[model samples]
Target: MHSKTASSSLSTSSRIVLPNDTNVLGNLMGGQLLNWMDITSAIAAHRHCGRVVVTAAVNNVSFNHPIALGDIVTIEAKVTRAFTSSMEVFMDVYVEHRLTGEKKKCNEAIYTFVAVDQNGKSIDVPELIPESEEEKSRYDAALRRRQLSLILAGRMNANEATELKALFEQ
Candidate 1:
């Protein structure tokens, strides 16, 4: 398959936080935000490979700030790296102030997805090319994260994790 640029698979979704989506503290529920993020990230993965994708893992979700009810939340997701059949997607969650219209980044998340065929078997995905500096950084870091995940899952030995090993060697 041909390579695709990260920007090409960019997926964005925006929605207002309603009463049903919030907690007793009037803040948007984390699970609700995660659901939105999964859909957006899957869209990005599908756009990159043109096949149905499934969420394999949810990683690195950082809740830096609370999003109050009535705020507009925008989720932007893009493919950071692609392996044989899996892709690492990164998302930025921003909250727009209902009153001032100001936007601030409130959270970030990383998700892993695997492309599948109609029969539900794993399928190959195209390679991802990152252009911008931030994309490049995230793309490079994806390898290290993958290595760590594999090690923790007992699928990879520490000695075989060259990318992650290099980080500690430095």
Candidate 2:
């Protein structure tokens, strides 16, 4: 397969926080938001690979602010990088006030997905080309994040993580 631009894999989802999606404090529940992000990010990964994709890891999530009930939540996800068979998707969550219509980013998440065949076996995916500054930044960071994750998972020795070592060498 040929390389794909990160922008070509962009995906978005919008939802209004409902009673079922909130906690007793009337704030949107983290689990509900996570579910939405998973679906949205999966779509982005699939778009990048043009194949079935499965979640391999939830690399990062930041619940920066609590979203109030009835707020309109929008999630924008895009593939940041692609490896042999996996792609990393980055997402930003924004909440719009129900009354004032004000919108602000409240959350961010990074997810990794593996492209799969009909039998669910991992398959190769096209390389990713990040055009925008933000996409390029995320693309570079994805390698560091992957190295950190590998270290944490005991899949790689800490000394072997060149990207992570750069952070401490400075």
Off by over 4 Å in 1: none
lDDT of 1 by residue, 120-165 (tens): 8998999999999999999999999888877876888999999899
Q: How far is candidate 1 from the true structure (C-alpha RMSD, Å)?
A: 1.0
Candidate RMSDs in order: 1.0, 0.9
**Candidate with maximal TM-score:** 2
Q: Cα deviation of 124 in candidate 1 (Å)?
A: 0.8
Error of 2 at 83 (Å): 0.7
Off by over 4 Å in 2: none
> In each prediction, how many residue pairs overlap at the backbone (N, C-alpha, C within less than 3 A)?
0, 0
Candidate 1 pairs with clashing backbones: none
Reference-based TM-score, model 2: 0.97
Q: For residues 1-170, could you state the per-residue lDDT of candidate 2 as single tens digits?
A: 79999999999999999999999999999999999999999999999999999998898998889999999999999999999998999999899999999999887899999999999999999999989899899999999998887788788999899988999999
